[model samples]
Target: MKTAMLNKYFNTPHESGLGKTLYQFNGLLVLTFFILTFLVWGGTGYSAGIMLLLSPLALFVKDRPLQITKEHYLIILAFSLMFVAHASAIYRGNSAAEITDLDQPMRFILIIPIFLYLKKVGFNQTWFWLGIYLAGLICGWQSIAYTAGEYGTRVSGPFNPIIWGDIGLVFCLVIGVKIHHLIKNKPQTLIPKYIELSTAAISLIAASIGVILSGSRGAWLTVILLALLFLTIAFVTLPKRISLAFTSVMIICSVLAYAYIPTVNVRINQVINELSSFELTSSNRSSTGLRLQMWYTSIIAFQESPIIGLGKSGLTELEKRLVNEDKINNWVVTESSQQHSDLFDMLAKSGALGVLILIFFYYSTMKAGSALIPPYSSTIVMTTLAYIGFGLTNTIFIGMNGTMFFLVFTVFTIVAGEREVTSK
Candidate 1:
């Protein structure tokens, strides 16, 4: 009986007046959410709330079944596993106060309904791309405005500098793919090819500039990675001369930034100096030193409880113990609560189980995204790569802004990609 109900629930499409109205409204919400995501504080959270609230209304339309598929299950299962992993860790640690941490994982689970709603409503891929382009422009201008103030060496949006720069860098990758799509497929009528091409090129430049000015060394590395990926793709798909020209431009830009941007130069030298001088017991206070120390401590914590791991309270208690035992510096614990890397944070707090779940989540995303057509597939894969890259040096999963941005953008791209595939 349950199987029958589920089959009935997943078979029908909403074609009624109310269904059409709900679909259009959801489309507008999605577009507006992306446009204001970087421009306003808590925008991603706000959008999440609205989507969760609105998704249930579809059930009121008689015979309006959810448009779910194997890909949707992959996404839903991945998120559900993340929640289970964290919940188990928290339960084992017996940390009632850390219950609030469940909120992030819960957001991922709630996205299951949003995915159904979006799949049924049927998004127009154009809106998604437009929102991305406009958002990139806003981020770029914000970066420029922040730099103009000369408040500090780095610039950012309303969010933290790392998250700000990371978003801009991802925008550069998405826009780069969009430009590639434009070049591959000529347009007709309303917008001239040259003008569209020029606008996209400008937006890509703006986003790159934003990433540079934000002064995140990790994001800078992502920029280099993106350039390499683009060059590789270009060589595979385009003429040799075009690929070489693009590579030369990237090299020139990198050189200019290194020479002219004090932040870039200083940061590069700081990393070199820190790496050369770093020792496990050196009481190093620099950013790189602190991260290395925290990572080492986290590994110790992981080793003690490899299964479910130590929950937040357990990790906190262990940190204090380590500090007292002189295994790690006091400054390491004082500087931040996180291990500065997503994998390490999970290992310390949730243990190997959490790390396994996180890996599964990433794998599921890539598996689901494999079906997307050209530029969209490349864009989705690159965005996923950016998250993995950023996670190496920073805790992308622990922060509200970073995690929310990843979840929201990931879902939007998946929905948009699916729609684009069906439309073709």
Candidate 2:
């Protein structure tokens, strides 16, 4: 009887024919979604909407039986607690009407089921990496446009300024791996090989230019980290000869580029100056200083209501208080926004509980990812690390675009890695 039930669950029509086509189509759609996401929202709301829409389809088309692991249960429990805490805040009127206004919280709820379905379908590592490369290319083009002054002086691309930095940082990793892959391969045709190399080179150059043009000191630091990670991974994984050649080429190119490009030199120096001069206490220093103040304010708010805190719209209320106290600058403080730290924002809004859940969510995802490392594992590892690094400075996961990319790509990376192991 158990065997029969298992067969029934795995033997679904969706595994082939229309279902198979749909599955492949959805993969393509997922790729398109990532490209547009960076170009549109910079990784925020619209991206989440795309994932929400597909989650149900993924659920409906799934041929395999559902399997919930212990980690899955933990995540669900955490999310549920967050929901309950927010609901309590809403009931107590601790949150503003506007904070309770949108469907973001609801969307996160919907994401739970979708994420489960995606876990079942899994993904191919190659496809996942390809998607990242495509996203990098699109972002690269936008960066070039910004540098050419086709757009604003600042490199805003499709996403907001903050997200643009994150996108650029991720692209550096995506492009680096792709270039490495292209160089390693010797295609049958010279033309195709040349084309592949050219495309990879262009993409890398574009992303590099974009990173520089972004004027995001954090992002610049993030890209440098990404480059180092890439080199380290290659040194550890690849053959000695290949690693040496790749490292040599990279160093030579870097030296040549730096020696000739005055603009690049100027930008690097400017970033160094900004980083050196940055202060945590000075409100007048820059946004980083403001962020430090906000962090302090959030900690104080968290202490006031350590358990559940203020609610979903808690930050808005905190911002109002800060403004009234004249603690925040008039020119910078606004009616809608709060501090830039996502963790601190959660602490002020949802309290310690919410922050704990979020940290757990990221921790579990990373843990899952850690067990699935291999040929493609390094790429996933680097990309995920880059996302986390960027998140420290910017709120990349709260909005639909950011949330969608974060959840989808993260799940895809794990699924793909697992699939590879199982196949072996």
| Reference-based TM-score, model 2 | 0.71
Q: For residues 283-350, what per-residue lDDT tens digits would candidate 1 score against the true structure? A: 76878998998898789888999987787678878888888888888887685467899888889888
Displacement of residue 310 (Cα, Å) in model 1 is 2.3
Report lDDT (CA) for all predictions.
0.76, 0.59
Model 2 stretches with alpha carbons more than 4 Å out? 1-16, 42-51, 54-92, 95-102, 120-127, 148-153, 175-202, 224-286, 311-326, 331-336, 373-376, 420-424
Q: Count the backbone clashes (under 3 Å) in each candidate.
A: 0, 9
Clashing pairs in 1: none
Candidate achieving the largest TM-score: 1
Task: Tell me the lDDT of model 1 at 195.
Answer: 80
Q: After superposition, which runs of candidate 1 have C-alpha atoms over 4 Å from their true positions? A: 1-15, 62-65, 148-151, 188-190, 226-250, 282-284, 420-424
